[model samples]
Target: MGKKYSDIKEKLQIVVDKKTTNDLAHLTHYFQNHKNGVSQCFRSSATEYLSELHEELNIAEEPNFQYYLPIKWDIPFPPTENPTFKFIDLFAGIGGIRLAYQNNGGKCVFTSEWDTYAKKTYEANFGEVPFGDITQISEKDIPDHDVLLGGFPCQPFSIAGVSKKNSLGRKHGFLDETQGTLFFDIARIIKHKKPKAFMLENVKNLVSHDKKKTFKVIISTLEKLGYNVHFKILNGKHYVPQNRERIIIVGFKKTVFKSKETFEFPDPQESNFVFKDILEPKVDDKYTLSDKLWNYLQEHARKHKAKGNGFGFGLTDLNGISRTISARYYKDGSEVLIPQKGKNPRRLTPRECARLQGFPDKFIIPVSNNQAYKQFGNSVVTPLIQAVAKNIVKELSKINESNQSKIAVHK
Candidate 1:
């Protein structure tokens, strides 16, 4: 019998140090658990690789088929028992959104993410490695899921759609539409799966992108797909020690929810969140900005101020929240630099970044510093996502309750 994810994860714990080995373990885990069986060719290849890995690593013991995951507070975030609903994690960066939904008693049925380093960290923590490159995936093969969760890509759509295309001699067509775009995959999957609900996250600028035409198209697309959509811009500062802001787009199938049924994003609650809460007591000297770099930064800031520009390295106060952490944070930590007494400001440790994003202490950072920074920077605020997911699940529960009541009355 092919090993399940729970079994494969144990084997991987020994060989996951190598990237290629990690990738093998991840792929095997995915195919082993997929509802749609892997094709014979793919299955054989994966199995053969595992067989070689075992021999190469010199394992001599019988396998423990009876594998059980740890509880919620452990290293890996396991699926909830008798989950209330199912969700798919798309563009799943280190699974911050997955953790949020899982806490709300949702099981992840499908996952897709592209970054190799992020996948390493994700598999380390989630057990199953995510399928990659959303554009390459076939929507028909996706399993049926109740809720679709994705933090989709949001490159600004050009405002002069007609003018730009006309100048390039390309007509406004499939190529001009969602073709070759990641959102196209989301649209196609929702059209095929017709999930009961979906929640999407993107940078706050998505609303104003291309002067709102981008958002307009997004809404129209979902409406055309028979879903009623609701959206709001939310700040991570409300739940964590960072001032990250993102927009969440949530929608419900018209068939599952009545036309009059409305959905609201979770209201932000007052939080005593601050940088001091997530800061590490001790950090390596390497994280501290060098004298040369620090001097250059100060000079750059002075020049900017002289020219009436506000651009400068953000020095975070221990008692206050931090500025946004971006993928480029590892380059210099300019956006959320931490101050050191009588010393140059330092960058946040990977662990601090994880905590800032509401990830648990047990969440492993298996990759290097650069990878960790990018992964966390691109990740969602888990507690904030959790609050929104709770509302979504609650609404879904209400629908289920109403349906059951109607069935009982008919009986």
Candidate 2:
């Protein structure tokens, strides 16, 4: 009923920050349920939350049946008007995957992001601050959902992670790893929630990590949970301008989709993507590297060259794809530097980073440059996720339709 989501956000923020027992996750759940006309699904709790919101807004309690929402609104990336499915985003980094599935008629029922800066940016755009930590939040607290989406931290199974561990002569992957526990958290939630479908993404090397034992545990675990699992190594460059490759795991609950053997990953896009597509029309001078840093990078590259190692800063080719952007990009703009005709190479502006990861221009970057770089570098390519989400929805809907037909026949 509010015009601008900013006002609504402030009001919701008060409720979230209040000293009461309720928290952000509870508020978001109530808001989504209220918006989607499904408050009855959690009747007693919904009524209590509605009363609290009404008191806070200084409004009379309207009938729950009158959960009317505007056909159009003023917020950036407003909630879907009608949702075909409900999803819960775990390890939701600024809600990138949530945005993709929402575009495909999915509603985000729950979200969890731990970083303060990330939560701020997420709230700015989505008007919902994600729950602080997934590990602390019990699976029972999560709202019922049809699909579960998580871009779980890749560091535990990534090339860099394994290399660092191996250099230190420490075990990596499932053994003697803190992050190894997180993967089990996902497994526990899946076993508890038993959502019809799920999608998990990690670095491309996950398939080869620990002599493929890491990936084997993942696949076998899902299969043991009665899921028809499929995974593929997909490069984001096909969908965006960055050459980020991640291994994607898709699964359908065998108990729900009895014919789950038919599940398939999305075919990779054949479209050509280049750096210029995401580059800004005009860039700020602040992005240009200082002479000292530039000189240091050159010397570093020269030293590596002398060693016959191909390690150094990557000067992006305007007509071609770029090296993978990483979380450490902010430390130095070495991974993907852009050349200027009369100036030193520059790091991509925050906006360019967002575009490189397929975030639309409307998506807000309310955080500072440092946080923005980290968020975008760690995010998934939305268009690529969209393509994969479409296939998952198609398979789920087909099974749903078949189930409905069987029910009809019995009736």
**What is each predicted model's overall lDDT from 0 to 1?**
0.77, 0.80
Model 2 misses residue 390 by how many Å? 0.7
Q: Give, for candidate 2, the lowest lDDT window spanning 10 residues.
A: 63-72
RMSD of each: 5.4, 3.4
TM-score (C-alpha) between model 1 and the true structure:
0.83
Best candidate, TM-score: 2
Query: What TM-score does structure 2 among the candidates reach?
Result: 0.89
Give me the candidate number with maximum lDDT: 2
TM-score of each: 0.83, 0.89
Model 1 steric clash pairs:
none
